[model samples]
Target: MHTHHQLIAEKSVIDTIVLSLPFILIITIYLTAVFISNKKYQRWPFYRIIFFIVGILCTAAALIGPIAESAHTNFQAHMVMHLLLGMLGPLLISLSAPMTLVLRNLSIKHARMLSKLLKSAYVQFICHPITAAILNIGGLWVLYTTDLFSMMHSSILVYTVVHLHIILAGYVFTISMIYIDPTPHRTSFYLRACILVIAMAGHNILSKWIYANPPAGVGKADAELGGMMMYYAGDAIDLVIVVILCYQFFKGNSYWTKKAHSLS
Candidate 1:
């Protein structure tokens, strides 16, 4: 289903260095902040350092890797990028506990300011499960299904905006599922699980749609491979989140049960 022309087009590089630069800067900045947070507050742990590094790599790869850059040329490629930035990046960063580290590093006043920012209406709205679901999966449906995919390469500004959305959406989605920082609005396991199911369905359906209809310049076969990648990768990352949420729930429940039994 993929003509040689289409396959080649899917592999073109508009400017790899242009794209790679900002992501590298971001990774550098976050890593530096992680170090500063540790030195300032003595909160550095080995596992967390690894997580921060991995999260940086995931985002950097999505923006700079040849495969990823090629994917940007066609609808399917962009979808693949979304999975890396919007799903994998956030999940890894969330696990690293960036929010907690930031809190630890700040003075009481500054930490209080951060808490207030977190509780701001914008944060509240973005981190809400439904809103995060919309930003994560809903964003894909918008890009691949319409003329937006074609528009991506035409404007550098548009390209930058879309990529930022992917990263931010991922953070929102991840923070909603776990408690790394404090959340003013928390959901029950049943509620979060229900939302996850719907989110996964959105992803699967979009992948299948791409398989059926490759966007401009994307071959059907490549679309299938990309779509399958999106489908499988999403499920795998989400499974990790589900395991974490369930583990936390059980851990909390067990602690409360022990305390109750002791009192009784």
Candidate 2:
């Protein structure tokens, strides 16, 4: 039995490394691209590179290490992974302006092709604040409210799909809320703000629900602790998004106001 347990542990370690390899390669490729871009154009901000690295590291830490291993058995650790993967990681990556960097590095023809892709109707619809909010908050609702959470633990493919959805939904929601990257289908500020508020409320309410009605197979105490972590940590990250949005809104207004005064 001890030998069997040791083999299981070793296999888990191997699986973790195997799962993490793709993400590590992605980060390496991104950093290499950024480095090449900086060399080509001295104007690439060093801070953006730092943000990208930090964002990738946050994602890696959540998905590839002890935290990820614990998350399978510990609700609190799962909440931490959710925050890192779904909120902080997405926000930091958005701030990195990766699309902008890619556009800068691409040839004009390729850049135009990318721009055209961004303008596609499907991209436009999904990038809408309302749609993004639904996918982001609504996804969490489905996962926790249904048997999906428990189901995910039983299937590695489902688990990967869910995590991928979390990251992608979070990224789309973050970009919709804030104009960090080139948004060909930009929604009005008021509309985006309204969606953001509704999404945040939904997220918080779900946390509270989980507190009272724990997910399948989760202990009440563990659920409560996880719920609290999700609530507080999510708010902390969302606050950053709120601040950036408000700053951009006010700064744009201020700039236009100054222009009006000058014209008068």
Candidate 3:
């Protein structure tokens, strides 16, 4: 078993690259962008230090920690890692309101670029709530139902692609459902909320499905336990999103209410 596990760990060069690249790049790119924006606007935030620390911790847990090492040998561990990377981490980072920070920090020109990016067709298609739901939840369905999950540790390309999906899907999903950033491509509050409900329900149901119908290579008991973990843990992170959205909605309503009273 030790030899077998060790052999499993001895992944291809591509796998090594894939495993490290996103972890490296996302932090690098995001920090760089944040720094540039901050410098431009003279916005120095101490909270940013905390964001980097926790963000890296979450990413490392999913990628380089003992949890990641065990993912090849244990299906439950892999599921947990997926939740950390693709669900919790993205959701938390989104709550950090990084995009807003950037917008507040950037010059008008850069803010306009950011807005334009949000409105672009590529962004519109990928960042739409429905599309994010498909990518985030549907990707899980594919990974388990197909051989993708089992094969991830073997090939770097597969692992890389899968990791990329996790991050992007998480990112797109967060941005689509929540209003942390200034979006030029705005969906109606009702529409976004309705989609959020459907997507959240779908995610919870997928966990149950995984429990009942264990994916290949994973035992039914393990899958069930893992699925349970996903159901509760995902919601804990999601509640913050719910709170933020409601706050934004209520704040907007209050502004309108005050305006109406003033006009009266």
Candidate 4:
């Protein structure tokens, strides 16, 4: 019994270390890119570095430690993890402009290749606001409304895949809405705004659905609390994205008008 307990403790430690490595690696790579880019070009923005680190920390906080463990059984905790992994982390990290930093750091030939990739039809399609919204918000609807949520807890592969999808989908959805990096395939502001509204409605509707119909294993009380958090907290983070998108639109319109007037 003592040996079995010791084995369990060792496995727990291993699990934590494994979980920590990705965030550590992300930070290290980002800082390295910042350092190289600052030397090659003008200094990379200090605030961007801070934003990247804090974003990564937010994701780490959700995936590791007590919150991650509790999420398996407690719906409220799971909701918190979802908010961190999907919405807040992605927004902050996108604001860091990691792709811009990478472009500055890469060789001219490699940079062009990356640019070409970005301009590809496949990239443009998947990065479309509508497509990203479906993947992010619609994916959540499928997960909560189906047996997928319960399966995620039972299977490690399912859990990892679901978490990865949440993060990637969120990041893509955010970058689609707000252009923080160089997007060769840019959509009109009005179009993106329309898509954003639709996506927001989908997300809100999903939260209310979760409130009324709990997932397979989650209890009623937990579902209620989780649903409320999902509704309100999701809005708060999304509001930041809306504000940024509006500012970008305003600046873009001002630029075109000024150029037009100068030509006249």
Best by lDDT: 4
User: Where in model 4 is the C-alpha error above 4 Å?
Assistant: 1-14
Alpha-carbon error at 10 in model 3, in Å?
15
* Ordered list by lDDT, greatest first: 4, 2, 1, 3
How would you encode candidate 3's per-residue C-alpha lDDT over 1-264 as one tens digit per residue? Answer: 558667766664447667777667767766777777675676646576466547666866798757887888777798789888997777767656677776776778998988888789998888888888889888877887678877887898999899979977987888888876677677777877877788778778888888888877788788888888888887777776677677888899999999999999
Tens digit per residue, CA lDDT, model 4, 68-135: 99998899999999999999999999999999998998899999999999999999999999899999
Of the two candidates 1 and 2, the one with more favorable lDDT, higher being better, is 2
Model 2 TM-score?
0.93
Clash count for each candidate, listed in order shown: 1, 0, 2, 0
Over 4 Å off, model 3? 1-45, 101-114
Quote each prediction's TM-score.
Answer: 0.85, 0.93, 0.81, 0.95
Query: What are the lDDT figures for the candidates, one per model?
Result: 0.80, 0.93, 0.78, 0.94
Residue range 205-249, candidate 2, lDDT tens digits:
999999999999999999999999999999999989999999999
Colliding pairs, model 2: none
Instruction: Mark the regions of model 1 whose C-alpha exceeds 4 Å error after superposition.
Output: 1-43, 73-79
**RMSD of candidate 4 to the true fold?**
1.8
Model 1 TM-score (2 dp): 0.85
Clashing pairs in 1: 71-77
Top-scoring candidate (TM-score)? 4
